[model samples]
Target: MARQVQFDQLGGPEVLTVREVEIAPPASGEVLIRVEAIGVNRAEVMFREGSYFLQPAFPSTLGYEAAGTVEALGEGVTHLAAGDPVGVVPAFSMNDYGTYGDHVVVPASAVVPRPPGITAVTAAAVWMAYITAYGALIDEGGLKPGDHVLVTAAAGGVGLAAIQTARRIGAVAVATTRSPDKKQALLDAGAAHVVVTDEEDLPTRVREITSGEGVRLAFDPIAGPGVDTLAEAIAAGGKLLVYGALDPRPTPLPNAALYPDLSTSMFTMFRVTAAPERLRRAVAFVNAGLSDGSLAPVVDRTFDLDDVAEAHRYMESNAQTGKIVMTVSHAPDAS
Candidate 1:
């Protein structure tokens, strides 16, 4: 039996429980992986709370990112063999496959070889954050060198990834966070400027930073009344991409009356992964960034597989500056 995380009810972190369950071999177009590390994302919290885009069935497993060595390959899977180190992308739906287990089965299309010199923990953290950022800022926003981009919630994994991805493209990344304490850390993480939202007005600070102009794109996860502030901070003809709903409050629509030139839309990483050519471009772009040291996965903390609930609590606390990774330990399969 393989140890996997599951929750029968929709609720908080306490609802999650680890259990030993039989894992079947991969079927056609699938690959079985012995998970070494799992990346914790805010989506899982929303999923467990029954607030995500996809709802879960009872006793469902939840996960998106994982890194490990391939243990078995299903029929027609010709590219990978057993013992190859790899990472699983968040391309598949959580309801269809999960990686929060010592051993997990995932679609072959979701598997990518881990680049040399990156540890499993780091590998586990890369895809979701970087790909999400790339899809929004690069693919969708059309970010260019010397252009300014606003990155809100600058301490989370995706926030940090957006900063790095912007810098990698020669654009300026302006990071925003409510905590003044994280300012220096965000600056050190490649953000050209840091905006403390609690102390400073977002639009004023962004305007000052841009010398009376505004950022070409504002990448935000928190969608509520605060979106009006972001709309004001965006330049005319720019875009405001909202990729997540960290705030459950109702969002206000302020574009038509205030900033008609500004365009706003919701984004997800699946938009890039769903298209084959786009996925190929995203993977190649991210791999090149990783190989060249332009995009580095910053792991803020780690927890044992059994401490998943605590990890979830930590993520919900918003105390982390980057990715929270879960280390998995495997035992010899008796089968």
Candidate 2:
């Protein structure tokens, strides 16, 4: 049996519970993994609250990212063997599979071999953030060298990943945070300039940073009433790629009459995963960044499997600057 997190009714962090579940053998095309570290994401929180893109069935398991060792493989699976280190990417639906457990059965296609020199914790942290940023900023937004890009809510895992990705592509990254506490951290993480939304005007700072011309692209996850401010910061003919609905309010588009060249679209990792060739390229790019120390997965804190509820509460508080990971402790085998 393995310990896993599940919620019968969706509401708040209190709804999640850890329980012992039977570890079933993987079926065909599935791989059984002994989870080492689980990466907590905002998506999971949204799903738990019954507001995510995918609705939850009663008693649903919740997770999308983890790093672990292959314990068993199903029929027709030959590429990976038992004991191989791997990372779980956000390539599958949480309704079908969940990584918040001591053991998980996931489609083999969703697993990637862990890059060398990266710890299990770091491997669990990188896939979702890097892939989401890569898909939005580079694959869909067409970010280019010398272009300026604005990243909103730029202190979370995905936001920091966007900053690093922009720097990796030789683009100027203008990051925004609600407070000044994370200003230096964002700068250290490759942001060309930092804007405190609570103190400075977002559009005015962006214009000054870009020397009167607005940013060429804006990557935003906080889509709500604040989106209009982001829209005002975009250059004419620029695009706003929004991938998350962190805000509960409706996202309004720029007035067509005033900014005819402004374009806006939604981005999700699902679109990138739909294309096999594009997914391969994204993986290669992230691997290269990890190898060269250009992309670093910052781990904010770790909790044991038993303290998952507290972990969820902490995540909901939004105090973490980077990834919140849960470490699993396995029982000793009695041979």
Cα RMSD for candidates in order: 1.5, 1.1
In terms of lDDT, the best-performing candidate is 1
Candidate 2: worst 10 consecutive residues by lDDT?
251-260
Q: Count backbone clashes in candidate 1.
A: 0
After superposition, candidate 2 runs with Cα above 4 Å error: none
TM-score of 2: 0.97
184-267 in candidate 2: lDDT tens per residue?
999988999999999999999999999888999999988887778888899998999988888888888767776788989989
Q: For each candidate in the order shown, give its overall lDDT on alpha carbons.
A: 0.93, 0.91
- Residue 285 CA displacement from its true place in model 1, Å: 1.4
Off by over 4 Å in 1: 332-335
